[model samples]
Target: MGEGNFNWSNEVLTRLISQAGLIALKLVLIIVLFFIIRALGKKLIGSAFEKYQKKNTVNAGRIRTLEKLSINVFSYALIFFTVVTALSNLGVSVTSIIAGAGVVGLAIGFGAQGLVSDVVTGFFVLLEKQIDVDDYVTVGGLDGVVEEVGLRTTQIRGFDGTLHFIPNREITTVSNHSRGNMRAMVDIGISYDDDIDRALSVIQEVCDKVSAEDSSFKDGPNVIGVQSLGASEIVLRVIGKTENGMQWAGERTLRKRLKEALDVNGIEIPYPHQVYMEKKADI
Candidate 1:
């Protein structure tokens, strides 16, 4: 009887060891398969995009944005599948776990509604081509150039070099400034004593010269006549159209050229002044 008891104990121990070894082996295989699949999937995605890029007449920036978003989505899916597979290999009931997760997700559906909205908004944003990488836009009360447009969030780099990540749902209205020709404008105030027609003539000459020389300009830096009458001077406005993202630099150059022209032509740009009287000694 003692010998039989020993044999039964050995048999149980052997079965347990075999089962544990099998589980370990399967886990290793799962990990290996996960990495192999991930690499192949990424390679396939890259090759597909490259082919599409050459064949399709879409903007490269938009294509790149889509590629990055696709990779993110692929990674998320792979991780989810890997986790589920690993759990199943451990003898866990994936169906039961998924059902439990569904119930819990429902329980907190109200709280998760924002996430859903974000995804939906992001989808529409992409579909409508509202914004693209490198596009300067104002949204969610922030002004910046878009760095990346993702499924959940959009990254924008501000003028001051601060990077901002904004949720898609919050971007209700987008003002894309890089869509067409940009306006380059500068306002110069000249003294009332200056000749309006002469000022206008010299300014137009300079505008004509700039428009001829600067290939960056799409249109003239012409003086738009008298913009306003200030307290001490008449404000003359120089307006020009330039390629997108060139407005600031173009405006600066235009302002410098106008100032030089005005100075050379003896047109006095107005400035604040005060006069003091000394009557104490006389009294």
Candidate 2:
């Protein structure tokens, strides 16, 4: 009887070792598959982006965002499936766990409504192409350049160098300034005593020069006539169309050129002036 018990114990030990080895092998295979899928997924996303970029340079930012999102989604999906398969191989009931998770998820769905909304909104944002990475936009009352559009949130870098991560659902209205040509408007002020016609002529000459030298201008930098008559000066408006995101630079360059042209022609930019009078009390 003692001999028989020893043989059974030895058999049990060998079977346990074999089971452990099998589990280890399965785990290793799962890990290797995960990495392989990750690498292939990234490569596919990169290739897709490259092809789309060659066809649509203007939408490069959107394409990049899409590529990043696709990679993230692919990685998560692969990891989740691989882990579940590994668990099943290790004698765990993945179907039961998934069912339990579904019940729990249903219970928590109400509390996670905002998260769901954010995800849904983000998906639509990607589909609609309302805003793209690097696009200057005003959304949720904040103006900035979009850095990333993720599944749950969008990142924007403000002009003040502040980075804002806003939930996608919060973005109700988007004012995209990078879609088309932008208007560059500069108002020049001159002393009222200055010749209006001469000032206009000088401004026109400067505008023509700017239009010729600067490639940013899409339309004529023509004088839009007098904009307003201020208390101390007359305001003349210079209007032009520039490629998106180049309006500010165009405006700055045009202002500098206009100032130089006016200075050369002896046109005075108006400034606040006060004449003081002093009367002796009763000399």
What C-alpha lDDT values do all the predictions have?
0.91, 0.92
lDDT string for model 2 (1-283, tens) is 9999999999999999999999999899889988988998899889988987888755788787888888878888888999899899989998899989988999899899999999999999989999888999998999999999988999999999999999999989999999989999999999989999999999999999999999999998999899998989999999999999999999999999999999999999987778899987996
Task: Provide backbone clash counts, one per model.
Answer: 0, 0
Per-residue lDDT, model 2, residue 82, is 91
How high is the lDDT of residue 24 in model 2? Answer: 98
Candidate whose TM-score is highest: 1
CA shift at 237, candidate 1, in angstroms?
A: 1.1
TM-scores of the candidates are 0.86, 0.84
Name the runs in model 2 displaced over 4 angstroms: 1-29, 55-58, 272-283
**Per-residue lDDT of 1-283 in model 1, one digit per residue for the tens?**
9999999999999999999999999999989998999899989998999999999898877887788789889989999999999999898999999989988889788788888888999999989999988899999999999988988999999999999999999998999998989999989888999899999999999899989989889988788899999999999899999999999999888889889999999999988889999778765
Clashing pairs in 2: none
Stretches of candidate 1 off by over 4 Å are 1-40, 99-102, 275-283
Residue 69 displacement (Å), model 2: 2.2
Top lDDT hit? 2
